[model samples]
Target: MSSKGSHSGWTRRRLLGRSVLAGAAVAAPSIVKGAQPTFAQTLSISALGKAKIDWQQFKGEDITVAVIPAGYFNNLIDVAGAFEDLSGVKVRFEKIPPGQIRQKILLDLSSKTGTYATHAADPMYYPLYVTNKWVEPLDAYLNDPKISDPGWFDYDDILEGWRSACSIEGKPYGIPFDGEATVQVYRKDVYEKAGIKPAQTLEQFVANAAKVHDPANRLWGAALRGFRGAGQNMYIYPSIFRAFGGEWFDPNKKLVVTTEPAVKALEWYVNLLRNYAPPGVENWNWPDIADAFGQGTVAVYIDAHSSAGVINDPQKSKVIGKIGYARWPRGPAGKRVTSIWNWSFPVNAALSERKKKATWLFIQWA
Candidate 1:
């Protein structure tokens, strides 16, 4: 979509095309179609220009980025107008819900339909992408003089754990945007009134929840992600599973979901939410749980650290300063296995060679 962010013939891109830094400031970007802002006024054209590559080479191309609707991903969409102005590439953001995005991304890539040039990716999917050759090796783009300036991109600035986790043989298949771990968030005021401290162990965790569970007051004990998706409940469950001493695979490399530890962990987790959480929690996702906590209807929550943004925002949260944060509690095995994950953006191998250039530009700029 063409940005309505333009006035007369002036744009951040037009200014950039003439002088890298001069006349940098203009009107705040108008909201473009979807969530994109109007111009790349905040982007440093001078630094990118130093690479001596043609930023406008793909000026008329269009690419779509399939993103799970979240703050970090929204931050990228917010500035897409600037990218569109700068590259003359029309960018569309499909802000799919978290539950449905994984399936769509997988199908788009595996089917090689090129429906999306890039997508919000999960770090765990890199190995499969590499093995199946479904994604372009990003090192080629990162090192290409025609499309990249490694020094300008600051390749080493990113954490090795995150960067390497998205690479195969030093060739990155994805660009990691956000790294997060699960944390326990509860209402401190409610806990104080109930005469209980935050949980340090699974036993204490449930006990604390039970102690504060006051559904009669419209306050349930806890709200957790219960929606059915690998990236939904499955994303939050591994921490619980590891805490319960459950391993995903046996030493011989067979799947291990039926093990005693696995069953015990799943049963405990399911029962906890079903019994103590608000009604219909089986259909809830992270945002839903966060909303419950923000609206003062839930006393505690367990989900991604990023969800804390929603729970702490004064604009949307009533609990505000009333919330307390802590590490995930210990399980019966005495292990505190917090969930660790990252979201990445990868170029779809399905995209045409020429379209991949525009996709790389978007990823690098983002």
Candidate 2:
């Protein structure tokens, strides 16, 4: 395939990196520095898109980046050799766990250590990062013709929702590395045998789940994240809360989890797990749910779009062509809500100007 057609797959893989290592949430740092790269020929198109930018602009600079040890960073490491050769910039990566990356970045910034010139920023914790002014605003680097080639980078091509999610107060703190949303993936064969179409409303979703549930025959109605903790609950609850017209906080920012809508949302969520989910689902996270769906042990699974890629891979999935994808069903409020997750690369404000600029070059390259 041509580079343009294949680029989306690469970007999708990068987006899925953080969630790849399930149940391995420990804090340790591993560094990957690119060796001198050699290329066979001059390529016309960049790995990013159809447009070509002058990547050699920042020759002979060194940059250090801290990232969660997800698939995205692994892919980045694979390509770093080429970037080093093209730009003459030695790129070093510090791999940290997804759960501890934020704390590590904060400490490095506050201590003026500049240990990491750039770090990955998760949208969930971006508000706090912005509040503390820990990341450098990327507007200047993005707009500079010398730094970013609009024709090549095509910043506007990024989905508006994804772009906006990475921005705070209308200013972009970082460039979007990956974007994803919650989606429902189901077994087409199972639905066909049961004579039911994909659910279009919340009520139908629940009913269909119950209808196809056959635990006695080793089939499950649904596979969902049921693990307790902010990381696990955050994925499933936000969409339910939004679907039910429940807000996390009032206009004054007071707690509102006990509101009528909130209660209904939580009740529905818990009941779905209690009644339809497989045994021991209470401890299941994304990886567990993904394994169930891929193994064809579940009829329906709802989580990030990242899992769909794995489920559709013929070699990795038992139900390859039998999968169907759909949006979340509409709630009683007539709204079908879903939450977004994005990873962005933001330069550390604590870095020297030269280091920041060099780091920006690497960010643009990635």
Candidate 3:
């Protein structure tokens, strides 16, 4: 299908295209109808630019990167060999568990050991990293003509929200590799049977969940992350809090999580899980919730957009064509708020200039 037609309408291709790794499962057609470019036809222009990137610019440079075992790691592994061959840059990946990768990177940065030239970063920690001068500012390399292919790199193609998310104090410290936002994905067939549309408001969301819930048949109304920790709670609760106009801290940085809006949002979040989620949901994290959704046991699932890619994959999901995606529901305060989750690549501030430039080239390739 033509790129214009593929994106202008809500075809399965378009739906999956929004997915993080959807390209791996779906085969691209060799030819496209009409006067439009096929995937291969567009590659010459889209891959980099008319002016190809000089991959060998930093040949024979070796750099280490620290990454969590997540989607980005899988993507990197898929093309790391090619990058090494073309650029003569020996890439070393230090795989760390998701929960510990942040701390590990921070320690490496603070110690100034330069153990890792570049590390995967979560935008949530941008403030902390910027405050400590742990990450290198990427503007110089990004704009340098000798180092980067501005036309091919197509920095503007990145979504503005993602760009802003990786920036601190108007300076970009990281390059967003993958981005996700909280969204509602539901069983469209179930909603159709119930004669209901996707929820637009928080109250309607709960009502829809209750209406479609069928425990006798092993189906639950919703699946969500409830594991207690910064990892789980921090990911799921902020949307509820923001929707209800709850702020975490005052202008002076005084704690405000105990305020009325905050308490109400928390109460609502707890009640939904307690009443509508599957049993043992209190221990569920992103993986558990995703598994439940993929198994066709949940009517509604709210989490990162990346999970939708998995749940929509025919090989991994029971509800491959039965899903519908929507933005997070609005709250009583007439606000719909969602949190952005991104994994970015940032150079270590401690790396030597040559290493930094080489790392930047790899980042661009990635």
Candidate 4:
């Protein structure tokens, strides 16, 4: 999408052009300075719904982007044209299904198929990416002096947990974008009507869920994701496990799937699903979660904060202004555990020197 008058709020320019690989930047001298871009010069980017992707100059060449359809990012139609305008490289973005995106990329990279020059995958996969050596290191680009707006990334604003996940052995593996943390989303009106404050601990959360749950009146206490797949296994399970004093791996990084915490967390989660959730929650994903919260069928939604935008949007939500946000409830461990969802862009390691240069340039400008 076209962005006018520069990005406001937080601008990151220092990270530009620091560690850029010489060959990657130097190989695309032609695309870099050869032809003047003939794309539309002016596009309205100030208004939320007014932005358009500039497709004039990007009629040819090969480029691809991977994206998931959720959060405010469902507006993927706006990114390509702008990239095409800035670089003559043709843009070919591949949007993947939310549940399948991570596994798809992992499989692609592990097999060395290298279909995309650049792809946007979640930061949660950083551990897998690093382990498999499927992603190219971004330090060169980050350290390059010619790149612009390195600080635009706002590394500090990212949650520390996510930061730790993206980094391995003190080296960063991905450029982070978008943040979704599990927070307590409740019905302010209902809470007031019941004269109950928002819940802040596992004990309090369960009690609150029971209080708000009135299934006979068609209102459930909570909306939980219990679908048995990556969504359930990864997204929904982590928080419960953590709250039950479970860590995915032992101190030595070995899997601890059969630990006491694991059993307790799963038991608690299953109980919530069996008692407090609405019908057919076993099939829910992002949309189902958003719909439940929006339709006011669930009084407390302990899901990602990304749904906040959708629930708060007037055009899409039926209970727009009534939903309120709060810190996640405390667990037995005396800590708040929130699941992390992140999307990030990565470059393919196997591209030709010429293509690599073009890809690096495109990523810098993007």
Candidate 5:
């Protein structure tokens, strides 16, 4: 609990900043050897034992990690047995749907139930956690020699934007486990067939989508999230908001959504979806968009770069080699802004000391 950091890496200025990984397909460390994700990429059971820390220090402890049943977290579940074998700690990862998990985690945190020792928390909630001191400042565990090896952990390998989002006032409340940035996804075959080039600006984007908007053939030009959840519509909106040079607040931190750029961006988005995208595009999320693209219905769309992973899976994708990616298009402001997203694990403050340490160990390892 005495954890604090004077290092500039942990600063309040970066709380919840969006980040895009530089040139890496995936942010998490992995050495995969096959098409499907497996434990082969995660840390080897013996490699973890060679670390200086005593992996078995908290043997016989039990900790539960609350997580969504997403690909990133499911990948962790596949390899969790390695940690359990090395440390003798029983880890129960409770996978819940996103909507229900939020309610569960909020209830657990607000009530101080300690039911979940850790969770893949929403970054936006870090400020509230820091304000209420509801989560452990992770600098203690990161710097503690007996518990972690900073060099081996390679915290620096993580993008600064992701690191910043998990920290408030230089105190890290969470450890980033997965991250992605918004990018333009399109079908190479569609573009080649239509002779449409990738859009460089917002106007060009619409034009390009229009050229490929073939409703008669059952192919739509583009898609964007219209669902109302925070991770749904709100998630995709920020990129367009930033691209139009619309900041969330002014100098006095006053909310400013009525500005010219903001309105223009909103109108542009509505028109794009209303005119060119497939039916019920208004209710789509990232998954729906990805699924549509993989099924060869959507000619182009903009979303998290990670969608490539799903669309490239030959097992389920119909456009494996036909898909393409590019940086998000610029808006009237001449700025290209990509939405940064991540999920991180934070230790619950309500847990007992032993359980907290056990949770930290799990965070470090898996």
Candidate 6:
């Protein structure tokens, strides 16, 4: 089946052609159908241009990268093998659990430790990295004609409101990778039964959720992360704060999580748990949520797009062909907020310039 959305023009073959061609003209197909490009494959011509790296020059070095477990980019052995085949450098990859990634990074960098030379991280750690000076700055690498593409990695694709999130003061600290945002997922069949369209407001969202929740049929109204640890607390509870016009920190940048809005957001999340979610949901992480949605147990999901590929995987999802997605609901603020990151390969400052260059080359291939 075509992954092409209604609005996109290019398809898988055309996207591949564009990637290979990079710039030269192509003869348009007469009856192109059912093959629009995947979002990841649709790189702007400028991005393809900027991704060029001279792998032949970086021949005799071993490059290692530290990545989070289940990290999609890191797990691409085909890309790594391609890089190794093109360049003689052997790739040493390591996956650290999310709970221990920070400490391990700190130990490696602070001690100028062995073999651990590069990092791939979510930008949420940017604040900590800057305060600790954990990773090297990429300004030199980005400015070097061999590496950075200013136009392709422009502020527009990064989104304006999120610019400050990844930047420290004014310097770009980290590149964004994947992010979690709650897109609306509802049972279109159930909505049709109840005579309601997809919702736009908080009240509407709640009402729709309640309507579709049929316990006799073992269907749940919603599925969300509420594991009570950093992952759940950070992703699921924070949106409620925004819904109530609350900010995590004050204008002066002090932690003010105790405010009324913050409390209300927590309350809303707790209520979601009590009312809409399936039993035993508070213990779920990413897998459980994906499974719940795939099994037809969930009527709604307010979670990350990181699981987009999994939801559509035919082997695992019962609702693979049935799901419909929309943006998160609006609140009084009239603006939407979602998390984003630049999960890029970051070289260590302490490494020699040659090694750093090789690291960037591997990153380009990655």
Q: What is the lDDT of residue 15 in candidate 3?
A: 31
- Worst lDDT run of 10 residues, candidate 3, spans 28-37
Against the true structure, what is each candidate's TM-score?
0.85, 0.81, 0.82, 0.77, 0.86, 0.76
Model 6 regions lying over 4 Å from their true place:
1-53, 68-71, 96-107, 146-164, 177-181, 229-231, 332-334
Q: Score residue 148 of candidate 4 by CA lDDT.
A: 30
lDDT of 5 by residue, 30-77 (tens): 222112222432334544555678899999998888887556665565
What is candidate 3's CA lDDT for residue 258? 88
Candidate 2 per-residue lDDT, tens place, 104-214, comes to 877887777888888887676667767888778888887887677665565666778878877888888877876778898899999999999888887788898999999
RMSD of 3: 7.0
Which regions of candidate 3 are displaced past 4 Å?
Answer: 1-54, 70-73, 229-231, 251-253
How many residue pairs clash per model? Answer: 3, 2, 1, 24, 2, 10
Maximum-TM-score candidate = 5
Candidate 4 ranges with C-alpha deviation above 4 Å: 1-60, 146-161, 231-233
Each prediction's Cα lDDT score? 0.77, 0.74, 0.75, 0.63, 0.77, 0.61
Clashing pairs in 1: 39-82, 40-82, 59-88
Q: Compare candidates 2 and 5 on TM-score and give the better one.
A: 5
TM-score, candidate 3, is: 0.82
**Residue pairs of candidate 6 with colliding backbone atoms:** 11-35, 11-36, 11-37, 175-342, 176-341, 176-342, 176-343, 177-341, 177-342, 177-343
Compose the digit string of candidate 3's lDDT tens values, residues 69-145: 55545545434554565567788777776667778877888899999888778788888888998888888877888
Q: Give the TM-score of candidate 6.
A: 0.76
Query: Which residue runs does candidate 5 get wrong by more than 4 Å?
Result: 1-43
- In model 1, the runs with Cα more than 4 Å from the true position are 1-43, 47-52, 168-171
For candidate 6, write residues 50-72 as lDDT tens digits. Answer: 33455567788877777665425
Which scores higher on lDDT, 3 or 4?
A: 3
